[model samples]
Structures are given as structure tokens and as C-alpha cells.
Target chain A: MTNTMTTRRKSNLTRGQLPKYTPWVVVAAAVVLAAAIMTLVGFSAFGWGVLAAILFTVGLTGISAAVEGARQAKDKLATCLVFGSFLIALLPLISVIWTVLVNGIPGLTFDFLFYSMNGVTGQFDDAAAAGEAPVVGGVYHAIVGTLLMTLWATLISVPVGLLAAVYLVEYSEGGRLAKAITFFVDVMTGIPSIVAGLFAVAFFAVVFGPGTKTGIVAAVALSVLMIPVVVRSTEEMLRIVPNELREASYALGVRKWRTITKVVIPTAISGIASGVTLAIARVVGETAPILVTAGFATSINFNVFSGWMASLPTFIYTQIITPTSPSNPDPSAQRAWAAALLLIILVMLLNLAARLIARFFAPKTGR
Target chain B: MSKQTSRAGDRIFSTTALMAGVLILVVLFSVAVFLLIQALPAFFADPSEITGGEGFWSYIWPIIVGTVIAAAIALILATPVALGVALFISHYAPRRLSQGLGYVIDLLAAIPSVIYGVWGITFLAVQLEPMYEWLAEYAGWIPIFAGPASATGKTMLTAGIVLAVMILPIITSISREIFLQTPKLHEEAALALGATRWEMIRMTVIPFGRPGVISAVMLGLGRALGETMAVALVLSTGPLILSLIQTGNSTIAAEIALNYPEAYGLRLAELIAAGLLLFIITLAVNMVARWVITRNKDFSGANA
Candidate 1:
């Protein structure tokens, strides 16, 4: 019987099975065939890639169906498509970063970081574009304005957001008022940034006369966007504080307020801090609200309550929309790209910091 | 601590918290009321005084159509790819690579809108202009791709593409979370029945994740509807037209952003009214999305 089995043409285990290297071989063959086909027509990188992908998919599916079964073929097709989708989605991200880096690095000079656009005029940009001078002016004023406005926004949003979250998780007990607050907060999250800008404009226009565009106005608009995020995240963090800790505090004769302030908040502080940082990151990049609320200023302004401000987002917007030198837009474009790079860096750093804080500061679960 | 002191502290603390909660409600209420008050002038303004020289409805109608068309384009383009990406992350990707992929997508979301706008006008539009020309040449019979492609590559179609890229991460992340929430037992059961991976996912995961995917798409729709900077910077605004390849069709958010800086008197109010319309539209979309999410919360395992 063993001799007969050994002499058999095929084993049961190996029947209808493709080798593990089948896909790689198929892909390699697809690439060669795709290239030959493309050469016969017009060879373009995009066309070659698309053709290779198509050939690979069809070839693999056909081979699998012939060797294995339709089910395995279908599974292979789905896997290919799913993986293809991921690669396609990644195209824009990779392109965006590549474009930014290539275009932004040249313009991101020391002068670009330090000098304000206060005295810099079209002449300067024109001269720079003509290679008569280095690219003049910088994002200093815009950076200062962004920092000041964001600081004020954080100051306004955090206390209110934290307290509201505390109320939702600790005091509301899912009551009618709490439900209403929770619902509205969710609604607030959906408010368009432009609409938030309009709200600030309308609110301040009614109070402080017709036209009041200042850093504070922009800060208020940002807080409108920032508050809901803070409330939602803080509320989640506070809710997960493990009821035992609060109960223990209560058992120790600590008051509700004291228990929350001492035990609950301390436990969830990491999450709350990270949430706040993310909120800041979110609002820092907002353009529409700042554009409408703070208007635009070429010069640096320190006063959030009074003068107009130029944020990094609006700076990039205005530079692109209405370049400093319409006659020679290269320098303006360069500056705009550099500012964009800076803004992206700021946002990325904040995101990284938030993640690091969340990972490192998580409370130990050990008893 | 003394009982009276403790009582005072508790009263103060709880009341302060309650007041903060109430303040949020008040702020939200005021946003609507204040916008309404500002927009009332446009509603009552003379018919000929509005932008279209006809009526407020006529003035706003084209932009509304433009906004809806842009958002629809974004939603249509992003939904399938986003679902694929979500499935790739939650199911197809190797275990160790999934979390890193999630972060990469989140990074896409982290980039500011203005940078997207800049990239759109400078890079994406330039890259797509040739394709738009090719489409206009070959597909001119299709009304949407009709001839006379944009010279600057700044058209509604281009803006829509940029918007698609912008909203992709939102849809992907939300859908990824929901897809990951599919019950392992159901997946295993489907597999145990000799089903393939695709069949298992189709039978178990897709059904469970349908509501989540819908809500995710809706949220992305809301975002695309209100996205301002990208459309404003990318689209070369003109009156509404059927041909998306043309340099026409302006969205509400883009219109408001471009005009608000120089606007005064009735123009400002008109823009504010436009903003009100945008606010209402997004609000409705988001509310429905949230309602869908909350309704499915019990069985979705999303919250868990």
C-alpha cells in the first residue's frame, strides 16, 4: 500500500494547491507583459502601473480559478483590490509630503523665520524673484499671532470644557439637562469653522459695534471650535476613572468635589492634557475663523484684545490668493510653501506629543 | 473639614460645573440666534439688491447647488476607497502594521486645510489639468465633462478632487473603528463554515459595519460641505454650470470666504445668510449621522 501511494501521481494534500511563490511569479510575469504592451503603445509610468495591476489581478484570479476554485479566486481578487485601495489612498499623502518638502525647504531660511512682513513690500519680493536679493520678510508676525491667539483660546476653552465634562460625567447622572448639554456639544462639533467665524463676527458686531476684527475675536471663534473637542475627550477620560477610586475616596470621608479634584482628575490628567493638546493642534491650523475674525495684518501685533492678527493659515492663504508681488509671484509662492511647512511641522509635533503623553502617562493597572 | 465648609465647597463646585455645562448650551443657542439676527437683513432686503439682481433665493440657489454637487462628488469618490482602506487596516493588514497604518491616516487628517488648499492649487490642479483636457476632448459628450476645460486647472472638478483627498481620512478612520469592532466569533463562525476570507467579511463584517459606514460617510459629507479654504483657493469661481470641467460653480463656504473680507453692508449680510444656510445643512447632516450612530450603539460594539 505504501509503495502504491508513493507511486501515485498526486497526493491528496497537494491536490488543487498552488505553490507559495505563485503570486510573486505571477506579478513578475505581469510586470514584463505590461511593459511590453505599454512599449507597443505609449510607455507612461501611470499607464504601466495600471496595466501591471490589472494584468496581475486578472492573471492571478484566472490561475487560481483554474488550479484551485472560484472561491479562492474571489478571495484573491478581494485581497488585491483591498491592498490596491490602500496604495491608491496613500498616493496623495506621499505626493503632498513630497511636494511640500521639495518646494518648502528652499524657502525655509533663517530670514524666513525671523523677519516680519511689516516693511517688506512688492519691491522686495520682485527683487528676490529677479535674483537681485534673497527672499525677504518672514512668518514671524504670523507665528506670534498664531501663538498668542491659540494661547488665549486654550485659556478660554480648557476650564469651561473641563468643568462641563466633569459635570457630564460626575454630576449630570444622565439627567435631562445633562442630556441636553451632551446633545448640544455634539451639535457644536459639527459647526462649520466658517460658521463659527460668522458666529463670532455676528456676536461681536452686535456688542462691540459693527466691525471688530482682532486676535480676541479670532480666539473666541477658535474656542468655539476647541470647546466641543475638549468636552468630548475630557468627558470620555473622566468616565473611565474606574469607579473604585471614587468610591474609596468617598469611603475616606472625602467630599464629592474633593474626591473628583484629587482622585479622579489626577488619574485622568494624562488623557485630559493630551486631549487639550489635540484641541490646540486642531484650532491652530484653522484658517477661515481667523481670516474673518482677526482680518489680516502685515505687521506683528501683541495685543489680542485690540489689533488685527495674521495667523499662519491666513498668511498662507493670502500669500497664495493675493501674492505679495503679482508681477513676480515666485517669492510669494516660496514664502507660502515655507509657511505651510512650518504649520504642518507645528501640527505634527503637537500630534506626536499628544500620543507620547497618552502612552507614557497612562495609569498603571496593577493592584 | 467642617460640614458647613464641605457643603459650601460642594455647592460651589457642582454649581460651577453645572454653569459651565449650561454655558455650552447658551453658546450654541446664541450661535444660531446671532447668525439669524445677522441674516435677517438679507431675508428682508430688496429683491434686486441681492447678488443675482433677482432675489435672495436666486442669489443663494446656485451656490447651494454648487456646494451639494461638490460634496456629492467628494462623497462618491471617497466612500468606496475609504471602505477599502478601512478594511485593509482592520482585516487585511498584518497585525503589527495596522496600528502604524492607522497613525499614517491620522497624520493625513492632522495636516491643515490651508496647506491642502495650497497644494491643490499649486500641485494637484496642475497635475490634473492635462487629464481634464483629455477628458474634455474624449468625454465631451458627457455633460459633466463638456468642452472648454479650465485654463488654470481651477475648476469645480479639481476642487471636488481636493475635497475628496481632504475628507478621505475622516471616513477611513471612523469606518476602520467600526470594521474593527466586528465580532470575532461571527468572523470565526463564517470561516468555520469553510467560507473564504472575503466571504466571511462580506457576510459578517459588512452587515455589522453598514450603519457605521453610513454614518461615517455622512460625517465626511458634512465636512466636505463646509470645507472652505481648499475650495476657495483651488476653484476659479464663476456662475453655476453643468460642466464640472469649466471654470465655474462656487460653493457657499468658498463664496463666503472670498467675499467676506471685502464685503460690507448687504453683501456682508448676504454672506452671513449663506453661512446660515451652510450651518443648517451641515447641522442636519451631522444630526442624522449622530442619530444613526447612537441608534446602532447597542449592537455595534463601536463604543466598546
Candidate 2:
């Protein structure tokens, strides 16, 4: 009886007085212990983190189990699991950020940033031997191509997607054709980007000539990929433009077209802009379709209508896969990483701007 | 006169809208037709003349197998972790933390696939060597882990792991959305019945989200099947599934990306044929995903 009683947890009155920050203290101790062990064993940094995480989990649960009792232990375990799972989910994301920054920074210099590699030798990277490293090149042409192609894609996709969305919400009235269109669009949403590229190639192959490659073709490919997303998002935005507003427009004796153009569109324009921006961000990193359609070029091709264009994605792809300097591909790898960083930055900035646009332009709700 | 103008304006806008909607169908149909037209020669060609020997079947079949196996690996690895994260966000995390975590996860989707490839090749493949070796040593009897771990770490297994990381976010976000939408009354009722927190979740949330979870996985599978660069960058070439631990193989879409640059004539045609297969597979998977979502709309616990 005495042994069992001694093993029992303390009463609430006594335990309540215990330090509330005890768990954090345990965590700090776990981290230090984990670090000491990792250093002694010569483990990697990742291993140290994993060890610390495990120690924290085990330590907290044990501490809670001993002091606070079983129910509290279970709760603490659940909490630890949640935090641990989140950390695990975040690991690769952290890896991505770290790798891009670490490997990408060394590749960014003035010449690498500014000059187009139009006249640069491709078969042999002579500049590499001269130690004028990074292959004496810049992604200027690729940057121009990416912007030019994406602009064309946005141009081609936005109006069509917007109108299609407006029609679905405003005029479909739940018709079968509308239903079918919605269903097909959902399916189209899953078509591989590479497949879209193939479609463009086949389209141009028959229409213009076999093996035709150009930025316009790539733009069309991107447009194919972007339309479904745009339609889906725009449709959601347009649907939410309160029926009361449409009724009010109708009550004012306005035509359907005019009401849609002025009231409905004006109300949803912000969300629409955000959606379009997101669609652009999504397709701008595409390499497969561009690889198939636009093809890679070392020099900048100003015209989208003819000639192969060098987009950032395809540029990175070629640089990584088949470095121009066979003797030392380190410069090429550096360039690829740099291009990747630029692409990530562009996408991230676009996302931020889209969120800002959505927030800034949102209609104020009456409190 | 004003009425006539208004009516004519309505007609024009409606027609334009109809045309735009119909254009989506046109594009979908034309992609199928285009792929078919381009691939017909490859399908009809003499088996003896195909690239990589043993005829077209040898070249194409292995790729299809590799794709399925890789996606299977991704699905297996990602599903549980994604579910845990989703559940953590939906049920466990503080409300503020859950929202922030969700936003962070969605950013995973925004990071470009090519960037994923870069990371996969430059970091993940190298970092996972110890794990592969460990598995090889301990689980040698298991066919998948039987042979020696490749020094390069460019095997299909590694590619799948990269893909697992790539697809985790989408699955997490979708299932998290579904789990979050569980009927609140059901949850309260379960709790009121003296069920443990996990029990309440198991009974209420997981049941409600089962269909959504399946659909989310299917969507992830769709993404994994079509992912190009990550697979291309992480994998070496050739079919190595029989050896399981062998360092080379390719998915159909990855093949397209890797081969498209230098491809001409039959090579390009064969690649397009592969793309066609990928298109059909994703299309079917997506159709089923839509069907699953729409079919259970009433049962999905949404009030509306």
C-alpha cells in the first residue's frame, strides 16, 4: 500500500504550484543534450535536429507522464506529434530554400546578370579557361524570353478565361452544356504541362510546318495550361459578386451586357487580377512545354513569331543537363542554380503582389 | 429601339461566352487528336526499328512500369505524413498556427517544379545516401531494398522520395481543407460522449474525410505521374526495376523532357506517344477524382 501510494501522482494542490514553464525547460535541456551527443558522435546537422526533436518528444512526454499523470502525458504526446509532423513537413521546404540560396548566390555577377550570351561560344567555353568564370554569360535573353512568352500567354488566356467564367456564372442557368464544360475543365486541369507542349508542337507541326519552334508556340502552350486555373478562379470570383448587385443593376433598367461589363466585372476585377497573376506564376516556371515548343536558344530572339526563344526554365534545363563547358561544368551548374533562384524570386514576388492586390482592393465590409 | 439594342447586346455577349466555353472543349479534343496523329507512326512502326532495342514495347513498357512504381512510392510515403500534417492543422494546432502552417504549405505549390528538380539533384539525392544504405543493409531480403545502394543515389527510389516531398503539400492542403470542413456538431457530439480526442477525430473527422482523402491522393498521384524535371534530374537512364536498387529508369513525362531536345523523327514521335499515354492516364484519374467529389456532394457533410 505504501509503495503504490508513493508511485501515485501528486495532488492537484501540490502540482498546480509547480512551474508552468517546466516543459520549455525540458526542451532546452533536450536541445543541449542532443547537441552534445551529436557532436560526440560526429553526426550531421540534420541528425542533430532529428535527435533534438526525438529527445524533446520523449523528454516532455516522460516529464508530463511522471508529474502531471497519464491524461496529461497523452495530451503532451499529441502536441509533440503535431509539432513534429509540422517540422517534418517543413524540412524539405527548408532544404529547397537553403540549396537555392547557397548554390545560387555565387552565380550572380554583373556580367552573368547583364549580358546576353548571344555571341558567346557554346561548343567550347573559352572564358571558363580564362577564369572569367560563370562562362561569360548572362540570362538576359532568357529573362526577355520568359517575360515575352508569359505576357503573350496571359494575353491569350485572360480574356477567354474571364468571359468563359462570366458566362458560366451569369448565363449558364445550370444548363447541361455548362455542366459539361465545367466537368471537362476540371479534367483539363490535370493535363500534364508536357502534354500541352506536345499539343502545341503537333498543332504547329501540321499548320505551319513540321518541327516549327517559336516563343508564340510556347505562349500558346502556356495559355493551354493557364486557362483552366484562370477559369476556375475567375468563376469563383465572379460567382461571389452578390446577386443583389446584379438585381440592383437590372432594377436600374440596365442591359445584361452593360451590367456584366460595368457592375459585375468592376466588383470582381480585383480577385480576377489576383487569379491571373497566380496563373502566370504557375506557368512561368514550366520547362517541359517550353523545351518542346520554344526550344532552347543561347542568343536572345526578340520576335515570338519566329525562331527559338530562350526562356529561363529551358535555359536552366539545358545548362544543367548538358553544360556548354564539358571540361568544367561547375559554371553551368552555377548558372542553373542562379536561374532557379531568379525564378523562385519572381514567383514569390508575384504571389506577394497578388495577395496585396487582393487585400488592398477588397471591398470593405461594414462593421 | 433601346430594347432591341439591349436584346442584341445580350445575344452577342452570350454567344461570345458560349464560344469561349466551347473553346476549352475544342482544345482538349485537339490535344488528343494531335497526340494521336503524331504517335500513329510510332504505334504502326516495325518493332525491329525502335530505339533502345527489343522493339517499341521494351522501350515504352518499362517507362510505364517505372512511372507507376514511382508514383506508388510517392503515394505510399506521402500519404501518412500528409494526413498527419493535415490532421495537425485541422484538429491539433492552435487556430492561428494552423492558418499560418497552411499558408506555408501552399507556398510549396508555388515553388516551381524545375526548382524542385534542382534541389532534388543537388541536395536530396546526395543526402539520402545513408538512408538507402541503411535500408539496403537491413532490408536486403525485401526485393525493393535487396541490391546494394547505388553510390550515385539516382535510382527510381530516390526519384520517388523527391516526388513524395513534391506532392506532399497538395495532399496536405486538400485533406486539411476536407478535415476542417467536418460537421462541427458531430465533433461536439463525439466529445460529449466522453470519447478521447483521438477517438473523437477517428470517429468524426476521418470518416467524414475518407472520400476527400482518396481524391486528394489521386490528385497527388496525377501530379506525380506527370512531374518531369524532378524525376528527370534525380533518375539515371534505362529500366532498372528488376534490380529495384539499380540506378536508372524514367517516367514517360520525364522521358519527354530529357529526350525532347535532341530528338528528331522517330525519337520525337515515340516521345509524343509516351506523352499521349500520360495525358490519357491523368485525364482518367482526374475524371474519377471529379466524379468522386461530385458524387458525394450530399454525403460530404457540406450544409449546402
Best by DockQ: 1
Which tens-of-lDDT digit does each residue in B1-304 have in candidate 2? 9899889999999899989999998999999999899988888788776887567777899899889988999999899889989988899888888788888988888898888887887788788777788888988788888768888777888888889988999899989989989999999999999676877887899899999999999999999999888888888878646555568767998888888888989888899999999999999888998888778777776764
TM-score of each: 0.97, 0.93
The DockQ scores of all candidates, in the order shown, are 0.85, 0.70
Compute the DockQ of candidate 1. 0.85
Q: State each candidate's chain A TM-score.
A: 0.95, 0.89
Off by over 4 Å in 1: A1-9, A12-14, B301-304
Report the TM-score of candidate 2, chain A only.
0.89
Q: Which ten residues in a row are the worst by lDDT in model 2 chain B? A: B237-246
lDDT of 2 at A209: 82
**lDDT of model 1, residue A322:** 92
Per-residue CA lDDT of model 1 for A230-281, tens digit only, reads: 9999999999999999999999999999999999999999999999999999
